[model samples]
Target: MLKTLGFAIICLLLFGRCAQQVSPTGGKKDSIPPNLIQSIPLNKTLNFKENRVELFFDEYVVVDNITQKLVITPEADNPYSYRLNGTSIVLNFKKQFQDSTTYTLNFGDAIKDFAERNPAKNLKLVFSTGSSLDSGRVYGMVKDVQTNKPLFDALVGLYNPTDTLNPAKQKPFYFSRTDSSGVFSIENVQTRNYTMIAIDDKNRNMLFNAKDERIGFLSKPISAGVDSVSYNILMALSDNTPLKVQRTLPKVNNYTVVFSKPIEKVKVTFMNKDSLPYMIENGEQIKFFNVQPHSDTTLVKLSVTDSLETSTEFDQKIAFQAPRGKERQKDQFTISSRPENNRPLANSFSYRLIFNKPVQTIEDSKIELITDSLTHETLKNFKSTWNETHNELTIEGKSFAKDTIKWEIPKGSVISVEGDTLARTLIKHPVLNEEDFGILRGKVIGADTSKLYKHFIIELMDDQYKVIDRQYSSPYNFIHIPQGKYFLRLILDLNDNKRWDTGQVNKGIQPEPIIYLPEKTLIKSNFELNDINITLPKAP
Candidate 1:
């Protein structure tokens, strides 16, 4: 009797310890995914007619992002309602199934363990209403035309155009997104003549709305036979109508006018057809300078006249106006000075004044130049020359050892183009030291000796990969560098437009290719790094 009671007590203690719950403390993280134990009607069931499915898991599971993860082919009118039953998932379909068809549901990363959120691998279920399943498939790749870079998760679809229908107007019969390598495939498509299209679908709607969507399509509908068809798509945007004025922006000294597409030339005039002073910032951006101040709002008309023909460019003429206060609207022309505190006059340099508008006059009497030498005497002889636009003044002078030049422009000494008085300012700049700067010279090697190597651009990038200097690539490349890590990149200029251009879809233009060097160049202080070679690869 004593032995029996002891054994019963020991069993009770052991069972109690085994049944107790444990808090997640220090241990190896749960890396194992959930396991599917069984499913209703079995997986890949032929002639399946059930409206509901129950999936049993080995451990407790949760269904999250059901809409995004669960992709159903031949989609029903409504969505599936999911229910959690401990270690099981109950999916009830609200829509009826189609007749004589194979329906597939891919639970993509949705079935995850409740505790660790580790998902089951490739959870898919398929059923056929008929005797067999459709084996027709479509596979292809998607890439950016200009960069030749893969576009992952881009949508590729097929539409059956039984009627005269536009591919962008309706949803596709079958669709799939590209994988990490920009590859896409759709199965069970039902062999037929289909209009194929690929799009960067931003709205998640299967249809293509051209306003913001990039599209790639075939010239004619493709016939999908029993065999899988391979189609490669190059994603690009359709070019907008040319010569249309997009918008106008008013800055402190200039009005920036933008166009819908690149134009060779543009003409700006007042309502009275007077020629306006303008600068071409780019093929699209035009800057009109020295706009006269008006007491009230003024109307400025812009016209774009291309070589082919002149259409009514902008939908409406851009308007211009000046400020209504005694103060001028333009921001003050400020002078920034940098002086080399150590090793002064190490290199010959220029003292400059960058003005926003053309300077009407400069009072040389009020200008004083003093050097931070022992004597600290003011200099009288100096020459100033303005740039072509008259907006910049470069002071030509001689350099001295251990001397820091101080330039002082007194108040009301300089006049703006608007006849407004300028304020007093002083500036000082440091000369470059050979010891502080490094010289980098290298031979561009490993270039493909093909005819396609002509118009490539060699770009010197900083540590952050920002362009520090750009030059036409040469056999021997040279540039002065400050002590920092740098890299080189080569861009193939196909259009000879002086820059990399993105391709147009409707125009069938491909984007320029770029070759980025993997090796990094480190420029150290007081060191001239020479014989550094850079090799460029073939264009993609």
Candidate 2:
């Protein structure tokens, strides 16, 4: 009986082990297929007379979308002549090869296996039907023109300027991709004068659509021959037609007119004609205004008035209903601190004033600063600057070593730029501190004195890659940033404007170039800043 019991126990243990081995709880092993072993005629071969080329791999590999991935440089008359039969990629030429010219076939991120879909990065083949292959190459870096930091994987291409073919309809004769350092290389280029363009393929279509895409280009033709060429490509927004307003919103008691571009001039007028209540505009950006109350419901129409006295009318209508509850009203002027803790000694601290309505201007005499201890009376001479873009007032003065400081803005003391009087009561605060403060500083250099970037942007980023601070300056301007570990970035202001612009698709305009600082270096905290020198590259 004891022997039988021992045997039963052994059988149960064996059954449990077998069940665990085959159960879903057991982890599965990852499988790696095979790599491409070799190809006939080799890669980058020159002076080839054969009409057909073959590629061979070690394992049973599958080819992915060969049509989109394979690009023939010095572009072939018929680019769609290649096919994959089983494990081999075959290229067939419909016409005779060009004499004494080199060609490159770049398979950009498209070569993958059948089973695992493993991609072969930058798989390219070069050959010539002539005596020698074109050995010229162009090397350069790409970055966000504004941030001055490297932009990886940006598409860089070369085109014949005289072709006159739309960039969207045709493929580039030569192309390459930017690396992690924002560096790109286009090799085996022929001897010719060509135009070079860098594009951020946001749509992955390998073309520059002005309205929806961003592009950068050399203003002049580039000569490439026997030696390698080096150039930096700055991406910029294309200047297509201005943005159009899509839809109007007056139903939620809020109306918005979206534009295809930033509005240069805006004039809003409410009109009642032919029983239609409409708001007309002579601008690209959407404008919002309070609507007049009419009974329980308000009806309104929207129209865009152009400079040429033409109006583009919309078919949609807007309606606003009365609120159900009692409305709450507060003071028109609201005062806030950047570092809300009232820590006076901190560097990032600042006093911000937001008006309920747009004020015509602010008067310098009505603003006042006081100290908590009452012993320091020299705080009255504070400098104030207003930012029209965000509609905020900035007041800067003597630094405080303590945790809090007193502030006073008396009524009728501040006047607007339009000479309008501020009638709100005085705003007084007891304590403000240093944790509410920040500083930024940098230096700008130019390719030459005459070619300085006029309106540039300097951005400071936190560790998580968020833009925590931003400042705009003219050429050779310095900025003070708050105390923090920041990644410094810069954008070249191409049009002498301080704002960043987007691209236009239908007009074939590319977006402006944005450059970023190298990731190897970053701005640190708590020290007298040094000049971050940036040298702008001349347009080719």
Candidate-wise lDDT, in order: 0.68, 0.58
**Model 1: clashing residue pairs?**
146-511, 338-429, 338-430, 339-430, 340-430
Report the lDDT tens digits of candidate 2 across residue range 1-540. 999999999999999788744435545542554455677677756677777777776555566677776777777776446777777777787766677878787776566666557666557778887877787888888866545567888888888876465566655788888899999988888777777878777776788766555567666678876675678766655544433566555533334566554345443333433121222233454434333443333233445444322345544333444445585222243444553424333333455665433455455554555454453433245666665433456666564435345555556665432233455543334343323434445565653463455567766677555776566653333234445566666666567566555543333444555566665344334344556666555665
Which lDDT tens digits does candidate 1 get at residues 1-540? 999999999999999988969796998998999888899868767787778988898999888888777877766565678999989998898865787887778787888998899999878777787778777788889986534567987888887755455546677777788899999988876777777778888876776665567777765677766676678887765443455557889755566777766665555556653434554555567666555534233356556754223444443333454546786566565443323223244334555667655666777766776555433323346676766545567766665635365566788887866566667776654555567767777655655464656677777778776776777766644445678888767777765667665454344344455666666788888888877666655545
Once all C-alphas are superposed, what RMSD does model 1 give against the true structure? 8.5
- Flag regions of model 1 displaced more than 4 Å: 1-33, 40-54, 73-86, 90-104, 109-112, 116-122, 126-267, 271-299, 303-312, 315-331, 334-415, 421-430, 435-453, 483-485, 521-540
Measured by lDDT, the strongest candidate is 1
TM-score of each: 0.62, 0.60
Q: Once model 2 is optimally superposed onto the true structure by TM-score, how far is the C-alpha of residue 103 displaced, in angstroms?
A: 3.1
